[model samples]
Target chain A: MALRLTGYDEVMAQDLIQSTWITAVRRLESFEWKSTLKTWLIGILINVNREQIHKEQKKKETEQVREDTMISKSGTVSGYDIEQGLIQLPIGYRRVIILHDIEGYQHKEIGAILGIEEGTSKSQLFQARKALRNWLTDNSNEE
Target chain B: MKSKMNHEELTPEERAAFDELSNFKLPPASLEARVINELKNQGLIEKQKTMNIYLKWTASVAASVLIFFAGSYWGKQSIENSDIDPNLAYMLILHEDESFRPGDPMAMFEEYGNWMQDIIDRGIKITGHELDNEAVMVKASSETHFGEEATERTSGYFIVEAESREEALEIARKNPHVKYGGTIELKPYVVR
Candidate 1:
C-alpha cells in the first residue's frame, strides 16, 4: 500500500513504513481502537508520506513532470499500464483512487483516513476514475 | 476517442487492473531489521547486553566447571544403577546475541545438519527450528508489543533425549551453538 501510494519508490516506501512503525509505537497508548490496527497504521503512513512530499516538494514536482511525459508515451491499457497510469496521477487523485478502487475503502473510511470531507472523498474518486479512464483509453487508441 | 461510461464506476478493464494492485507485496526483509535497529537506538526496544569481556569469560569458565563436576557425578551414578531412565527428554533453548558467529548461511545450515546427525547417531531423538525476527509480546493488560523484548532472542530450540538433567546439560554443552558463542538453557519436560 505504501509502495503504490509513493509511486513505487522503494526507498521512500521503506522510509514511510519505518516512520509509521515508530510513530505507531510512540502513540500506542492514545490508540482508542476506534479503527482496526491496520487502518491506524495506514493512517500514519499516509501522514508520513504527505510530510515527506512536503519536504521534497521541488524534487517531486520535477519527477512528476517526467512521469507525466512517460505516461503520455506509454501505449496500450494493461495491468502494468494501469499501475504506470497511477504513478503518473496527481497525488490527491492517486490517493483517492487507491483508497477507493484499489483498497476497497468507502468514502466514509477514506475521509477518516485522509482527513477529508466524505463528499470530497466521493468527488475525488469520481474525478480520479475519470482521469484514469481517459489516460487508459487514450493509450489504447494510440496502440 | 473515449467510451461513454459513468465516471463513478470504473470500466471492467480498469477494475481488473486495480485488482492487480490490491495483491500485497512483501517489503524487503532488511527493512524490518532497519526498523528494529532504529527502535533499539531510540530506546523503545531493549538493547543487547553490554557485559565486560572479562566478566563474560569468568562466567563461562565457572559454568564449565560446574557442568563438568555435575556431569561426572551423574555419569558415575547412572553407570552404577540401571534404574535411571536413559531416554529422558530435555529442551535446549538456544539464545543468541551479537557475539553469535553465524558465518555464511549455507555453512551454518551444514553445521546444524552435522550437529543433528551426531545426536541421531548417538540414538537420541532431536527436533528443532530456527525462529524468525518478528515477535509480538502480549501482556495481561491487553496491550501488544512488537519486536524483540530482551537482549538475547531465542534463536532456536531442540528437544533431545538424554539420561538425566546432567546428561542433558552435557549434550547441550556440545551443541554447535555453544561453540558459536550462543547460550543454551537445558530444561526437562514434565511428564503428566
Candidate 2:
C-alpha cells in the first residue's frame, strides 16, 4: 500500500516503511491495543506516505501527479479500469477512498491518519467516489 | 497485513471496484526482507531510535550536560560520519574538448563504458544520453545574434546522486574522459 501510495517508487516506500518500523519498535510499550496492531501499523504507513506526498508536492507540485503509478505498476488496477480511476484521484481523495472503502478505515481513523477533520475525510471519500464514477464514464466514452 | 476489511457496502459498481483493488499486490519479497533486515540490523528500538518520547526529554538534558566537555563537538562529527546524505543530486558535466582524442580509441571507450556500468550498478546514475560530435549552437543577446557559434560544445552529461562537490568530483574523475584529453566537470544538479 505504501508503494502504491508513493506512485510505485518501491525504494522510497521501503525507506518510509523502515522508518515506520523504527517508530513502532520504539513505541511498542505505549500501544494500548485499542486498535488492532495492523490498524496501528497501517496508520504509521499512511503517515509516512502522506509525508512523502507532501515532500514531492512541495518539490514538484502538480508535476508529481504521476499517471505512471496507475498505468505502470498498478496490478489488478490496470488500464482504464475503476482501479486506474481510483489511483488517478487527487492524493487526498485517493487516500480517503483507499482507507475508507478499500482498507475499511473509518472516517475518524482516516482523519487521525491524514491529520484532517473527520468531516473532511468523509466528504473527501464522497467526492472521491463521485470522481471515480465520472472517470469510468469518461474512460468508457474514450473507449 | 491483512487488507480485506470491508464494513460499509458501496453501490454495486463501487463495491466491485473496491473489491478488485483490495487484492492489490504486496511489494516484492526482496523489498520486505530488506526492510526487516535493516530494522533488525539497526536494532530498531534498542539502538539510536529510542521508542520513548520521555527519553527525548532526557536527551535534551544529556545534550546540555555535554556542553561542558569537548565531546559535544565530536558528537556533530559522529553524525556526519554515520549516514550518507541522500538528498543532493550530482551531475557529471562532460566537457567535449573537440580536438581531444585518446591514442587507442576502442580501449578508451570500453574503459568508459565499464566505469559507467559500475555507477549504474550502484544505482547512482539517473539517465544519460551522449550526443554525437556534430555541433550546432544558437546565440541571442542585446547585440546582433549569431547562428552556429563555435565556442559552445558539450559531448554529453550524466546525473548522479552525491552529497557534496568533493563527492561529485570523486564520481566524475572515474569518467574515462579524465585519462584521455576530454575533460569531466562536476556540477551539482539543481532541481528547479
Tens-place lDDT per residue, model 2, B48-150, is 3343332332122112122111111111111112222335776676764556554343243236546654664565534343444345445564343323333
Predict model 2's lDDT versus the native. 0.53
Residue B94, candidate 2: Cα error in Å is 65
Task: Give candidate 2 misplaced runs (Cα > 4 Å).
Answer: A56-80, A141-143, B1-9, B45-192
Among all candidates shown, the one with the greatest TM-score? 1
lDDT values for all models: 0.61, 0.53
State residue B25's C-alpha deviation in candidate 1, in Å.
2.1
Q: Which candidate is the best by DockQ?
A: 1
**lDDT of each residue in B76-135, candidate 1, tens digit only:** 111112222334778888887778764433233335545654665576655443454445
Runs with alpha carbons beyond 4 Å of true place in candidate 1? A58-76, A141-143, B1-3, B47-192
How far out, in Å, is residue B68 in model 2? Answer: 46
lDDT of 2 by residue, A7-109 (tens): 4566776676666656655555555445534455567666666676677563221233343432323222332365566556776677777777766677887
TM-score of 2: 0.46
True contacts kept of each: 0.39, 0.19
**How many clashing pairs per prediction, in order?**
0, 1
